[model samples]
Structures are given as structure tokens and as C-alpha cells.
Target: MSAALRADPLADDTIAAILAGYGGSQWEAIALVNRLLAQWQSNADVQGWQAPDGTPAPIAAALQAYLAAAATLPAWADAARIERAEELFFDMSMLSCSLLFCASLPECYVVPDLAGVLHVAGQLEAHCDYRVRSTAAMIFPVMMKGGLASPQGGGIAQILKVRLIHATIRHLIVRGNPAQAAGAAVPALDAPCRHLYDTLYNHGWDVPANGLPCNQEELAYTLLTFHYIFLRGLRRLGLGLAPQDEEAYLHAWNVVGHVLGIEDGLLTHDMAQAEASFAALQARGRQSPFLPDPRPALGAALMRAMQDQIPLRLLKPFPVLLTRYLCGDAARIDLALDQRVNLLSRALFGAGMGLARAIDSVVRLALPGFSICRMMTRIVGYQFTVKFLMNQTRPLKLPPALLNQVGHTVRAWGDDPKAPRWMNALEARLAGRKARRAAPGGQPC
Candidate 1:
């Protein structure tokens, strides 16, 4: 057994206490986000078509203050390391996105509670494409240069927004139909194991009216999915990183985990730690009484949507084949992928991938700095983004009504009828604010 497993990690009670301590803060953060959304809406109404600079007066000031407080880099964070990680990330953007969507997402459904929450929330129903697009939108900005720490970048802001959305999910699941939530539950286990089980399988212990929905452990589990899972997927693709670069990537995400309210203990700093943590978590998941519902319909929907992005008909099947390849047969079956590839087709796909990898190897050997893989990633990522954005008449964004129904005040901006009105008003308000500030008074009244 790994030393980590042998160390006798914190008892269930200790973990629970830690979770409880953080739960309140998470709700408070959500409350603040709720207000921010309202403020953004109101500001947009006043400003007209121009995007709000995240500065006006109290609203912008409040958001900036919250970000400033929450966005601190962890004591262990390394600026130079983070820079290298970001470069590596852009260099392999396409593969990263593929792993996230095809591999990581499918793997997520393996966790019964997560699948239950997403299913009950209707996030996987008819609006699956929107949910996927929204998630991508949140992640892309953060991966870009200067994104995580910069107030102007979407990293911190987008993550915080996702955290709020998680809170909203917890609220909805707890308060929604009891039957549905129960259906989502894993089978009962013995008392001693129950707490750990609940932590891993159930969302968390039931709380009083004021208690939060999700717990710290659940949040940490998600952080692992993004950090460990993504890295593992890359390794599987035969894309190796320098040991320092690997650690740096993990370190950068550890900073993100800290900002997202995950405890330091759960944040992984290196590949060894990540592997141990991942194995332990997976073992716990296997103990769940329930099997995940045949991969949420959303998986298939996402695959179909991806097909539209690739121009060549021959490459249309490539996405599904790639997903199947990355996730393996078990995941494909669990996800209920409807398409079937004959042996010949599978062989062809395998050969193509092998040839591509071989070509990439030669290119890397000939010119270490120039990566054909990176070029492919850029082209593929751009095409996918263009198609995803245009999927809806209005540019798609997240925290859709399905997920945010509990917070009635929170609505999907993409589908909002008032979008144009608010947008037009925002331009006027921003212009007026600028003019007033320029006029002798130093600030707009």
C-alpha cells in the first residue's frame, strides 16, 4: 500500500468537522455570487451594449474585493512553475479538451451522487449541449496566460461562478423531489464505513435549514477529476511532460483548488501524490451500492455536437472513436454510446492514431520547440469553439435555468429575452459613467 494510505488519514469525524467549517463559507460565497449576477444584469441594463468592465461603482467594487480576498495564491505557489504549466497547457489544448470532455466527463458519471445531481437537475436532459459549452467557456479563460490571478481574466471569476453553481445544485437536489434524490442515493452501508461512504457516494450529511448542500470532500473529489484525471489522460496518450512541468501543472491547479475552497490536504502537488489519492478515491467509489445510470444521455449528445465541428465526414466518427479509445470499452458502455464501430473501423482508427503519434514523434525529434501536436490542437480547438458558440442563436453561457432553478433570480443569460435591452442600456450607462468621471468630479455620481 502507498504510504499515504498507510498513514491513517484523518478519521471520518475529523473530515466531517472540516467540511462543516467550510460549508458555511461556501454558502456565503454563493449568496455573494447571487448578488453579483443581479448587479451584472442591472449594470448591463444601464450600460447598454458594451460589456461591463467589472467596474462601475459598488457592484464592481464588491466583486473586485471578493476576488481579491479569494484569489490569493497559496504559500506554496511558484510563479515560474505556473508560467511553464500555462505554456504546456496551450501547447496541448486540443488533447486537454478532449480528455476533459470524453474521458473525464464520462468518468464523472461513474460517481453515483454526481450523476444523480446532474440528472435530477436536468443538466443532462435536453440542454446537455449548453451545459457542455458553458463548462468549456468557464475553463478556457482560466487556462490562458494571466488568467487565474488577473482580475481582467476569467480564471478566478469563472471558477467562483462554478462554485456558486455547485451550491445551487446542492440546494436544488436537497429541496427538490425526495423520490428523485433518493433514487440517486447509493445503497446503505455499515456505520463506521458510512461516513466515508457518504463522503464519497452521497453528497453529505443532511443539514438543518441553514446548512449547505455539498461538503468539502465532494468538492475535493471534483478538483481531483480535473487535475489528476486530465494529467493521467495525457500520459495515456503517450504525451509525456518533463517531471518539473508535470509538477508545475499540478501546482497551478492546486492554487485553483485552494481558491475554490478545497482543503490543502486534498490538494496534490506531484504525480505520486495524485496517483495515490486517485486510487483511494476510485476504491471508495467502487464500494457504492449503485452503478451509475447508463452513461447520462448527455454524453451521447455531446459526441453528436462535436461531430458538427469537424468538417470532414471521415473525421466525423473520429471524435466518438477517440472518446472510446481514451475512455476504453467500459466507459463507452457505461456512457451508453449508441454508435458501434466494426473491427475494421476500429483497426483503421488505431492505425491512424499510431501514424499521427509517429509523425508527431519525428517532428519533435527534428525540432523540439515546434510541435505539430500543438498546431493540430489549435486548429481543432478553434473549430470546436466556433461551432459550439454558434450552436445557439445567442452565444451560449452557463448556470442555465435547469441548474439554477432553485435560485430563481439566477437565469441563463444566453436565453434571456431581456439580453438585448440590457446590453443596449449597458453601453449607454458605461458611456455616461466615463463622461461623468472625465468631467471635473473625479468620479461619477
Candidate 2:
């Protein structure tokens, strides 16, 4: 690695920004750390609770060791970097959820307040709109339908239409940015966004409904949209998963690829191949197998949640209440369901309630003294995988040198471009490229 690349990206300014994101959230961080540690303690408690008498002692020992490793890693070691990532990711999650929620509302025929909604667009100052638009698209469907309790507002079709509208506005906003450098301008967005607006305005809500008959195709297009978002997020932040965790990262990437119908030959580990590999491992008992069990239950649960027609059933009263309190709106109650059934049935929906119940079950199953850490890790990973897969991000191959430099700079500045180095090199290169084109005179190809 070049010297610049080898330097830690979490230099001074970056650390400051990172520290700021988590400053007031220390209690949460400490609780998380404690929870991770307690998960190990739960394991020891497990031997006494659930483990069979014949189960090997090594299982507990291995888990203990992993927890120890996690705990001993200094909280501040890469504190800023992690916090910055979490901050952006958490914000994006909330924003995307809010956008979908609003779009789901009966009154929001076409989502409005473009300037307010697109404020996060400023986060993409470093990347192009195509990249931004794509990411937004992929995430749109999932976020719209995700973790919801309602059926009518949460269907994939409604989600797609809302996403298309959001994408159209996002494109227009980019094209209309007066501050964008000439070299960085994305003129192509103007036509497409306008075309989509016209389509939606002229034809009403029937465009995507009539156009995309296949659910998988709709899923694929939406996935493509958010792929760009994830890419832009990663790019703008100058972040990459640690190389040591390549397998884990690739697994997450492949999950999204599967949903998108993109064949990358990475995630195609079929049943036969899986069985063959399992047979080759002459390891311990069946329950204690060496291979990590793949998570299919999550996909099933997510699909179920999307098809849920009511929100009150899916989310806890606290979240619903909090959402209303923050937004200054009255909590929406399902009077129709209540009158037919009872008051108790009004607050919860099938899928949201189902997911909450399942999550609780899994957590409890992992409790009584152990496996909570593993469960939490697994849950966090799946959430990330789902989010990542649903993202509109894509891969862009930069010159290795440039990648390293940007990565290093991000590490230092906490991935904020407001710091000095981000635009310095990019501006110089863009200027150089512009000069070369301009030297050839008018309309240089």
C-alpha cells in the first residue's frame, strides 16, 4: 500500500466529527457493549439452562473467547469511524422510513416537500446523481414496505410508485443545482425525472402498475435503485468493510444480488453444494456443525411484514407514540378493525406484531445465561444485510491508488468533505480533465 493509503483514515478532524455523532449516545453504546458482554454471560448460564448434559464444553469456551475479543477491543480505537458510519446509516434508515410512511398515507398522492426531504441529498455532494438515484430506488421499495403493520399502505406496488416519484424529484433537484461544478454536472437527470413526472401526472397511479407485471421484476428494479444509494453512502463516506471480514461482507452483498436477480456467481451456493460441503466437514455433533447456518427465516418474515395491512399491530405502542409525538400528529388508530373485533386489536397488526414476537422469541431462546451475544450479532447482521441488499448502491472501480488515498482521507476527516483534502485532489483532477477538453477548442468531444 502507498504511504498515503496505509495511513489511518481516522485522523484528527474525522475523529471529531465521529465523536460528535455519538457524544450523547454513550449510554446507548455502553449498554450495547454491556449487552454484548452479557450475551457471553448468558451462554454460561445456558449450560445450566438449555444445553444437554452430553453437549461438549468447547462450545461455551469458543463463544466466551469471541466475546472476550469483542470486549477487549478499545471503544475509542476506531470510535469516530464507527460512529460516523452508524450516524449516517441510522439517519438514512429513519429518513427512508419516514419517506415511505408519508407516501403510504392516503393524502400523499405524490410525495411533496422535495427540498426538505432531499436535505440528505447534501450528503451526496461528492458523488454523481446516477449513483444517488440508483441507491434511493433500491431502498425505496424495501423501506416503504419494510417493518410495517399495514397491508394497503405497505404493498410493494404502492411502494414502487412512491419511489418512482421520489426518484424523479431527486433527479430534478440534482439537475437544478446551481452550485455544482461544470465537470460534475448531471444533465441527464432532467429528461428522465421530467418524463416520469409527466407519466405519473398524465396517467395517474397506473403507470408502474401496468408496466411491471412481475413482482420479482419490480423487486429487481427497486433493488437496483438502492444499490446506488449504498454505493454513494460508501463512496461519500470513504468507507470499506475490513478485508478480514470479506466472507461476511460478501455474504451480505450476495443476499441483495439474489433479491435483484443479479447473477454474480458469488451467492449461488445451492443445496447440493451446501450438502456436499457439510458432509466434508468431519466436525462435531449435528447441532454443533462447523458451517454457519444460513438465515432463510428472516426473508420469510420480512415478506410477511410487507404484506401486513395495519401498522398498529406491527410496531410497539412506544414507537408509534414516539413517531406521532415527534411529528406532532395524532397517533392513527384503526377504528375499522377495532369496531369489528375489539379495542385490544387496534394497536397491533399481524406482521409487525409477528416480527416483534419473533425477535423477542429469538432473544429469549438465546437467554437463560448465554447465546444473546450471538443472537444480537446475528440480528444486527441480518438487519444490515437486508438494508444493504435493499440499498441502490453499486460497485465502482477506482484506481487502487485513488481508492487508498480517498479511504485514508476519509479515515482522517471522519468522512466529512467539509475538511480540506476531499475536494483538493478531486478538484485538481477535474480541472485538469476540463483543461484537456477545452484545449481542443469549441465542443471538444
Candidate 3:
């Protein structure tokens, strides 16, 4: 990461403007954060927004100004490429969910500095589900149809709120100064902050050592995890996209990075640039060891949470194995997933992977589109969707309307129009869905 990029956090503008507009009052800033939380929780539709109840006019105006500007598409944003990327994501469907849970998220925790911030703000070991769910909350909105382009799509609205949330985290952690760079160093280690809502106040962050919480460098790295790492995972599973498709996917997420207030220089458009940048940033982040070493605990908690979601005993180990497979030795070692799984799970996973690859190689000769690996991964993905995304008891903290939309999307993933009839039936039985829609894609093909 560049020194200038590392020095600046994204909150330097819009959020700063909002807080300053509120007269820089400590009580007012806190109130605004709380108010945003309340308003967002109750409202799913983001096409039109209103000032939250009891919002001071100045603060509300500042927020309105920020959203209006932040929600806009960049001058260079390509609508065609973005729509193509959306199509690719939709076609990938349930398999995308598997990659997200196993690849993108596990790799996210591999960054020491980012994990350190999560440690501070998230009692991650205890609230593992919240970490997973919250990540999905952003992802679902961003990838949903017209999520970024249309006013009706929730992506821009949710991303604007997330951008603010990042700034708010920095504000509270640094005691509203927002200038942690020049601050006196707090002691290196202190009691870990366990507060749920307010990881809100002092968590004894050594800003000189850690940079700012949710700094630009870290945010950019995370965008890579979702786009670059996810694509990389697809390749590892023998499901790589066409070059144009890959570039389109990267483009779509770079747009999201822009929305999240990440610097343009930090975003990469191709896999080669992405790999080099990701490696450089990971190396830079690791050079300064984040104390308390949050990666292992955070990794364990994430794996355990995921494992708990799968009912099939044999499949419980799949999340860890898939994560370790997608992320190589370096990340595997970092996350402490280097340990061996039970002999049976290992043997079965190893054999299953080999069979999938062998079958895919032969099948592709006759039907160039077929991939057993894709089917296998989609089945695993379906399990994650049903357990994590479709759980009625603890539905995503989305407005009722958006939650309904998400549920419909997940259910539709049960049918694959492109797959052979037999494969679709197998997918249905294995995924515990009733059956494919009688006519796939709503036509009698």
C-alpha cells in the first residue's frame, strides 16, 4: 500500500462534513449514529429517503447531501459491463454463495490489520454469526439485480450507510478526533473491548501502530476479497469465467469500492494486478503484527459458525476444507486451518474432488458447459443458503420487502436451466428442494 493511501482514511470528506455540520458535538455525533441505525433498520426501500425522526435539520441536510452525491454512478462506470457482471453472478447462483462463505470471507480475515479492527469492534469469537450475516447483508444488496444502477436497488443505499458506519467506527474509536495519526500512542495491550453495540468508545487502539480503523487500505483490500478472491476461488474449483466476464466482475466490484470511499489507485481491474496488489498489501499489513493475533480466533469462530449451519455430518467439514483449498498455504497457516480434518472427511473430500475434476474433463468434450465441480460446489452452496441466508428465525436485518426478495432469489437458485434434467433432479434431491420448475427458465425447452 502507498504511504499516502495508508495515511488517509475514507472518512475525510462526507462523514466528516456530516459530523462537522452537527457542530462537532460529541452527544450529537453519537445521536446521529444511533439515529441512522434506527432509521436504516426500519426502512428497506432506499429510492426515496427522509430525515430520521428527531434529526437536527443541519445534520439531516448534511446526510442528505452526502447520500445524493455518494449514490451516483461514476462518470466512467460502464453500464453494459456492470449488467454483464450481474448476469455472471446470477448464473453462478448458489455456487457464488459457497465461494463467498468459504473463499472471500476466510481470506478477508487473513489480513492482520483488518482482523485487528474486527477484534476491536467485533467480539468476533462470540458474535461470529453477526460477522458473517453483516458481510452478506452488504453483498446481497450489491449483487442483486440493478443493485448499483437503479434507484430502486438497495446496494447504493446500503453502501452509503456502510461508508458512514466505517467513519462512525473511526470517530468513536479515536474519540471523535478523526486525527489518530498524530495522537499519542495508547498502551499496546489492554482489556479487549466486549461491548456489543458500542465497540463504540475507547478500545485502547494504538493508532500509530495500527493506522485508522477501516482505513482506505483495508477497505480496498476487502473489495479484492469479494471480487478477486471470489474469482480466484472459482478458478480453483475448475469454474473460471471467460476473460471478459472476469474483467466485468472486477469492474463491477471496483465500482463498489468507489462507493465505499476507497481510493481509485487501490482498485485493480485484472487478476494480475489484483494478485500483485493483494500480495503487497498483505505483506505490508503483516510487517506490523497486529497484537492479540486475532486471525486464529476469528478464523475458528467463523469456521465453527459455518459448520454449525450444516446438518449433514459428512458435510460439516466441507467449509473448512474448501476454505483451506481456496486460500493457499500462507492464508491457511494464518487462519490456523492447517490442521488435518478427520480421516474420513479428508478421504472423502479428496476423492470427491478428484472424481469431479476427472468427470468434468471428459464431460466438457461432449457438452462444453458441464462441470461436476460446479454442481458439487453448488450443492454445498445451497446448504449455506438454506441455513444462513434463509433462516426465518434470524432473517437478514433487512426491511421485510427486501428480505422477501432475497428469499425468492435463494429459492429460485434450486433450479438450473442450463443443467441436464438428471443433474437438476440430483441437485434438487441433494439440496432438499422439491424439484426443478417444470419448464426451466419459464419456457418449454
Clash counts for all predictions: 14, 44, 0
Error of 1 at 28 (Å): 17
Q: What C-alpha lDDT, on a 0 to 100 scale, does residue 83 get in candidate 2?
A: 31
Query: Which residue window of length 10 is worst by lDDT in model 1?
Result: 409-418
Native-to-model Cα distance after best TM-score fit, residue 294 in candidate 1, in Å: 5.3
lDDT, each prediction? 0.52, 0.27, 0.77
Ranking of predictions according to TM-score: 3, 1, 2
The true-structure Cα RMSD of candidate 2 reads 28.8
Over 175-228, each residue of candidate 3 has an lDDT whose tens digit, in order, gives: 554653445454433545445434546565667777777877888888999999
- For candidate 3, give the lDDT of residue 183: 51
Encode model 2's per-residue lDDT on 367-441: one tens digit a residue: 322222222222222222233322325322222332333233222321112212322233334222221222223
| Best candidate according to lDDT | 3
The alpha-carbon lDDT assigned to residue 278 of candidate 3 equals 87
lDDT of 1 by residue, 1-445 (tens): 2111111112122222323333355334334446555432211122222225633344344444444445456777777887777777665644566677666666666555455455544446556675676666655655666656554444665565565455455433343322224223333334342322233233432332112234454556666777777877677666667788888888888887776666687778888988888666655644442333524476776777777777766656766777776666765765677476666657767886677577767866654543333333334444554445434555545334221221221111111121223332343242222211132432221
Residue 250 error, candidate 2, Å: 29
> Can you tell me which runs of candidate 3 are displaced by over 4 Å?
1-54, 180-183, 187-194, 197-200, 440-445
